[model samples]
Target chain A: MPKKIGSKTLLLTSSPSIIGYAAVGAKKEKQGPLADYFDYLSEDSSFGEKTWEKAETLMQKKAIELALQKCSVQKTDVDFLFAGDLLNQCIGSAYASRDMAMPFFGLYGACSTMSESLCLAAMFVDGQLANRCVAATSSHFCSAERQFRFPLEYGGQRTPTSQWTVTGSGACVVAPSKQAPYLRAVTVGTVADLGITDINNMGAAMAPAAAQTLCQFFSDTSTRPEDYDLILTGDLGFVGSRLLERMMQAEGYPMAKLHNDCGLMIYDRVKQDVHAGGSGCGCAASVLCSFILPQIACQRLKNVLFMATGALMSPTSNQQGESIPGIAHLLHISAFPNEKEAK
Target chain B: MTKQEYALWAQQESPKSKGLGDILRAFLFGGLICVIGQLLIFFFENRGAGEMAPVFASACLVVLSAILTGINIYDNIAKYAGAGTLVPITGFANSMVSAAMEFKTEGFILGLGAKMFIIAGPVIVYGVSASVIYGIILFLLG
Candidate 1:
């Protein structure tokens, strides 16, 4: 008889190191992204190097600490650490983890880092490789956009279908057994590109990928939208989420009633004035960590399909006029088994 | 189409055909965009993102409205709050993204590259054109 795959626990979580956000009153450089907004940087300091690195490192340290605190597990108890971030050469993550002093298996899934890390950590724990482990992903809005697209100094208008970069981070822990918090199922995705090329606005560009991945997840799990309490999309924002819903419906799989984008949940719509919703790796990661996890811990909701989507296209590819390629990873997170099951 | 026909088409295509409900909705949506932009101005200023708040916020509002429009929220809002959604940066964002998406299927080379100029194209053109005229006037005056 097959052993039942019981509840997998959430041991801890963390996000990409964070950079000091762009000041609100900065001047707009004639050709920079925020050159006109030059006055927003704090009086303490405007923009600088190492800020990104600093953000990434601090977040990682916090994640490790949080995991230790919540799970009451030692750094040494975590047999492996799976992490990723939107930094050149994964330097932010690798460098951050180096200080934590844990065995590391660094990954790169762009915005899909959360699911990537979670999936791997779940496998290790499920296989009984280790009693406890952690999975996490992090991103900084300024650092990501600067590296991927235009410099922060470049000032230009944005398209409506564009996604705002979220300036936050997220991290989470995973462990084997149906203890307290757990990962239920995971679905890896295939590549999907409707061949959109406008890199500046990622919502439209990555919508097809989100649609493809969600549809595939449903197929792989043979489940429908109602199967889970919430079909949480990682960062497909407003436009992408709509398109994903529409495409799924067109493809004979609709998710109209139960779908939400993490980017959409972060900022208050009336207050933030962010249009077309938020994006970036941190958008989903932060929403999951700060908002979603808290809700899950409180038992306000159950069975979350955390599908982190990504734009796999590089800047070189965009500059080359190639269609944007997209990917997604689906992680099924649920409450841990009851007291009886744990025993 | 003849010039006369084209002019008629333009007249018909103008975003002003709806009734008072539509107009009010647009105005309200537009005002909401402005309000959001204002709040962003304050938010970023507090956070010290910079004085570029208005410019960035305006641009972001346009894009946001455009996204809402693409998702059909802007339209529904416009239907009730008409120019409310149509007059702000959100409107601008809606215009650009919708146009870009329309032309995306044309293939990257001619479609995406060429169509990028569709919405922002006029802005670039008029911006450069106005700047050129302004330069000439300044040159003559100076």
Candidate 2:
């Protein structure tokens, strides 16, 4: 059974473990600093597909397949699949799960899709609604570029604040098992809009939501920043991460020492020429699957707060002059199920 | 903090563009593009196509822009060159050609044909409308 914590947080008594996970990345991500962490890296961004959209679908499927294979979990054994991407209508996850024949829940949380899906999947497993579930998300640089910004070959200058959408996919299978890394709790965030309207500065738009969520979790659980080994936010990039640190400091959390963003961890900004590091759903997803999970699994990190922030605005919304609204979903993952409670 | 206060703080925290450096690069690259156009015009004039030199040069530039876009080199140049690449005739051709190449995946009639002018459509619309207004005013003055 799941226990309700203060306000927005939920503590999972079952502590569903992420039994298997995998990350797949394309050329740009391969060139990144965390390149060696990826399960599979392809020099071809298209992934042998005719179109970028189709390539995204294939990449997502490959990630899920790799995750399942890692745990020797057959496709028929999984109970539910939660997946999404940055594509319109979540066609990436839709088409990716089409041939799998699993009970699918399609989600759209922009860059926060990974955490959103993972939180829900963990909840379902915690409540015993499903025996095993898979959470997955993907994003492609080419597909996202054409849809959100300009064409791939369009001659336009990118602002320094603009983030490069990572071309990658990440998938994980969560089940009720005594695995080393376990899902302890989760916090669902409220939308925060501070009248930020700049389309290029997503970090600025999302930082508020991340601060709100992290603050809420800290207050709810009566925990301090020193309690967690790492406080990781998804794809806030350089600008958002700094803003989040300042906001957290103002709230008395002072998490600068403990905090690290998935965006900054995924790329070497200076060497990769990624102006504000990486963004998109895959940025957090791949980093979590490859780098963070492995650390927790090996007991190197005892406790972690993984919160992924998302800017919830479409191209139409931006063009219509609507301000960007941001949301963040958080999961408290730990190496032991009842370690904090015992402490 | 209040939204207004946070916005102000964020504005100050964000990095600003290097104004002088960007302007200098833009000037240099933009001037270089004009030089290429002049060379094309001279080449056409030397071939004795005096009346059609400008037209031939523009066509050659457009074709060169399309080729550069196809080879995936124009955007990289534009990144550093900034407005230098965008203010020239090649930029216009790049915009149209890039859109055409991107949307071609959807289909021919709806995707390529319709979206081919998506980026440059406003420029064409306003340009022709302004020209018509100018012509009307010129006739009235005469």
Candidate 3:
């Protein structure tokens, strides 16, 4: 095993290559700022499914199918699948995986499930336990609304601090290969809470966790802000993104350039009515698959630290007056020139 | 740091609402909604509804609001108009229309019927009780 850099980060001894990835977003997402980044946008939010839940299931299925197809790996060839969604029992992922028929590990890291699955997949591939593993996660605006906030039928007035849940899915494959773009390291974050109660203002609830994990990652690796080409964070919407910067600036780090948020990237703040920005696990997941991965693949960027942040709260927990807790997972994704012919 | 202290710092660090622009938009759009309602009342009176003109006008207003919501116009207006769209009776119609539009999927019965009262339920409950309590007080005073 590679020597541990810090308290939370693990430097992978055998860095596993991210072989394939796919992103599927809904119509509203197509109209967003990163419209060109997605692999496909459903003509309708339903994607020809009868219900929002079923539609989400289809989206997850499409993402996984396309990701594996890109790597020339069939459903039968996939050793295991790691997947999750913002749904009761993660039904969207479960229903989709039942068809793939691979041994599955259902994860629940809330919005951070994408990175959690990716980290676990890298572990499996790096350990030689699996030659290839598929990681996927999905979220839908309607499904998340009904489950978390209020039924859309409620016509709940969104506060300015509220973020729009992104309707999308993202999937990728991790494999044992000596390749250019690979998972070099990972940092699993601890759950941090500031006792934030406003469900609409997830940005504030989640920012502290993001800041703590970030401080931990920097301290452990002894890395400066200049080391990474891009330091991307997941789902810290407009408010949280700025708040995180302020919180970190006080920590004695100058983080103006090279910092971006997937939530901010997923939607247009001015034109779109999404108050804060696009959120949900799908926001970061889809952006990583469609936009960030391509950047690495084309060598437009060399090194990036992708941190997927999540607010780990449940309907029961929130309803019962429990404070929202947040977590963030980090992956050190870097690229070098391919020695072999690039695929 | 203590949770409350951290919470206060977090809240301060959080973004504040652009109240001035929002208030102006809300006022202008709210005035526009009132103007439309008055126009409907005039139209109903011109048709000889006389004593019942306001009742007909209210019905027309509700229908107009539902249609606006159906074609996705109301939400666009509500996005900017803020309390202006919310203060009008049209907003009540919007709540019902939005509910049906959102819950139309679960086969119309359990989905639509069950969820249809999300906003109206609270509004109706308080409205009825308040009126009943006021009625008793007025009756006793008289």
Candidate 4:
């Protein structure tokens, strides 16, 4: 039987273990706060490829390779590969997975792809569908900018609300082994559109979705801010993070102590000059693999709630002046309560 | 907070507004592009290309922009220089090449060919039509 909790939450009975994680970032991401945490940093944004799109594909491939290497797992051992990216038709994942030679499930949740991939991967393992699977995602600033907003030479001015797309890739190996942190539960949120139309302000557009998912997760689990060691949002940046806090406070949920945004954490806002902060599929993916997962491995962060948010806006939709819809998928990761402790 | 209050708070938390430095940078880079164009024209004209100098110079500028867009240098320039890059013909070339590059993964005929004119298609259509209409008017007037 499926372990479906209230409305959108899923309490995974068979806790899937995150056996290993690998992170790779482009030039700008390498110069950020979590630079040291990344497994590899490419000096060349092209990743030795001529085009940005190809570079993103190489990045996803490299992330999966490195993660598999970390866990000493062979390609044949992995039952399935779950991957996605911000490219058109999710070419990054398809191209990467093609070379990987594994059964693949290509996904597209825009920036929320990390959590989405993880949520689905966890479900597969929890239901005894797979013994091992790899979840990976990538995003390139150049690729996303050209595809979504404006061409590099357009010289179009970016508003203050605009965020820099992060160029990075992150991958993780999920196994049935109890050697690492386990994914306890998942909360998949509904699409939220609060009538936000401005493409320059994705934080404002995605903030509502983050807030709703957080509220639903808390209410379903009957937990408080004290429950989790940290509650991290994917790439909401400064504006969306603060908006989420305010929305939670209105519901009497104090999130000040355990909340952080990966967008804001990636760069130094004033010094780096990343308006708002880093954002993209890679934004949360890189941060999780580079920073959060390592901290959890060391027992520094215990019970954590990670909410990856995505602003589902295509060029056609933006051109049609449709309101941007946001979606957030959350997962609960715990490093403690080891096999010994549980026994 | 109420909806209005939340909106106001979010706005307040936005990044720093554009400063005078941004305008100055944009102006400098924009002027630099024009200067490059002028220099190319001068070089070509001095080489005995005469009236064809301006044409070669513009073609060269567009080619340069397209290449830079490929190497990803034009984006950094646009980031700091802002709209200065877009005002020139080089910007249009960048759009075409970038669209082609982005959609190439979809397939050659459908992806690259279809999206190739996403930004420039309208301009070419209107440009040709307008020139033809002007020519007709001139002929009638004459």
- Clashes within 3 Å, all models in order: 86, 0, 0, 1
Can you write out model 1's per-residue Cα lDDT over A236-328, one digit (the tens) per residue? 776677667766777787777788987677655335545666676656766676556655555576667788888887877887889777778
CA RMSD for every model?
15.1, 1.2, 3.2, 4.1
Best by DockQ: 2
lDDT of predicted model 1: 0.61
Per-residue lDDT of candidate 2, residues A1-343 (tens digit): 8898899899999899999999999998888889999999999999999999999999999999999999999999999999999999999999999999899999999999999999999999999999999999999999999889999999998888889999999999999998868999999989999888999999999999999999999998999999999999999998999999999999988999999998998889989888888999999999999999999998899899998889999999999999999999999999998866436
Residue range B1-142, candidate 1, lDDT tens digits: 2334423432332223336655565566566667778898888778777878777766677666656656655544543454455445555565556555545545777965776565556776887999999999999999
Q: What's the TM-score of each model vs. the native?
A: 0.61, 0.98, 0.90, 0.83
C-alpha DockQ for predicted model 1: 0.03
> Which lDDT value does model 4 have at A115?
96
Pairs of colliding residues, candidate 2: none
Candidate 1 wrong stretches, greater than 4 Å: A1-50, A336-343, B1-142
Error of 1 at A48 (Å): 11
User: Which stretch of 10 consecutive residues in model 1 chain B shows the poorest summed lDDT?
Assistant: B6-15
Tens-place lDDT digits, model 2, residues B13-130: 6777878999999999999988998999999999999989989998998899999999999999998999999989999999999999999998999999999998999989998999
lDDT of 3 by residue, A237-323 (tens): 987887788777888766758789999998888788788898998998999998999898777878888888899988789889999
| Per-residue lDDT of model 4, residues A1-343, tens digit only | 1388778888887777899899999889878888999999999999988788889999989999999999999998889898999988999999988878889999999999999999988888888899898989999998898778765544456788888999999998987876647888999978998877778889988988988898898888888889789999999987788778877888789897789999999888778888789899999999999999988877788888999999998989998989899999999988853335544
Interface RMSD of each: 14.8, 0.9, 2.6, 3.1
- Model 1: CAPRI class: incorrect
